[model samples]
Target: MQNSLQGIELFKASVSISHQENCASGTCIDKNLLENYPPELIVGFQLLESVERSGTRRFAIHCGSADNQQHNGLLAWVFNTDLRYSFKDTSSASRSISAKCAMKVFYKHVANVQPLVNPDLGMPSVTSLEELRLPLHIYHCIKTVLEKSTSLLPPSGRKFGEWEIGLLDLESA
Candidate 1:
């Protein structure tokens, strides 16, 4: 799932960060975020991550004042399809945010995973979690084994037969 988005580039787009009616009762956490705030004609914002709940996808956006100026690293979430991939308008007017602001996009921090001692090898070998590939078939196989292993109440404390492990050769795929 994570691999599909590798090397993707950020594109500029617009979205309505509006106040839902329920947000007006002050019962909302972000109800006050846009209050008394003048809308800018253009604002720099970055689409960060997307989290799905039930069946709907809610996307996270990273927002802050332009880098040349002072701005708070504030975050906002939009629930719908991606704003970057589609264009829509008129129903909800998109507000440009900032006071004497320049639009700037901020990206989430990313770093390489560090190598660690492999538990199976005890003190002898080192391994990287990134090197291990959990393909769908293998994942389901392991999940089935685990489900069977823990199916009984109190777990039964039983040991299973020797496992057949296989590697997915990316070159073949």
Candidate 2:
């Protein structure tokens, strides 16, 4: 309920104290948050964002036929995010705009953690985002930190089949 997901809060309190900790997102609800939201909502959010960044509209339509469509995209997205982090806005490079976009959405939705590059450390570290990693990792990190926190549903409940197809029933469209 607090504005921030405090790491110390999660660590100090026993999970059993709140049924909240049992769910993937760690939000307190009468039932599991996974059961609270519709699958389409999650899928739609992801697919729409994906299409927006890539400027492609066929990914979801052909998703079923493509092998490992979603999985590959995820790996690629992660790679791209890493690349973008390493090199911001470099021209003539295989610029990972998709990853940057996803990370933006992710940071906005999950934990409200802003990415900061400390001049002293010379690397990035998430202050609030750390609290979200556990439930997300348990939930297979399907949605980014922002999506998990702000979105109505979590990734485990998302239904990809209903979307307008793209490349291989992957729902990239």
RMSD of 2: 19.2
Which segments of model 2 are wrong by more than 4 Å?
1-35, 61-173
In Å, residue 63's CA in model 1 sits off its true spot by: 32
- Summed backbone clashes in each candidate are 2, 27
For residues 1-173, could you state the per-residue lDDT of candidate 2 as single tens digits? 32354324341111323334556665545633333223223443444555467643322111111122222112111111211222234464776543222222221122212222111356755332111122223223333322343333345533233321111112221
Task: Quote model 1's TM-score.
Answer: 0.16
State each model's CA lDDT, in order: 0.25, 0.28
Candidate 1 local accuracy as lDDT?
Answer: 0.25
Q: Residue 86, candidate 2: how far off, in angstroms?
A: 45
TM-score of each: 0.16, 0.21
Best by lDDT: 2
User: Candidate 1: minimum summed lDDT over ten consecutive residues — where?
Assistant: 164-173
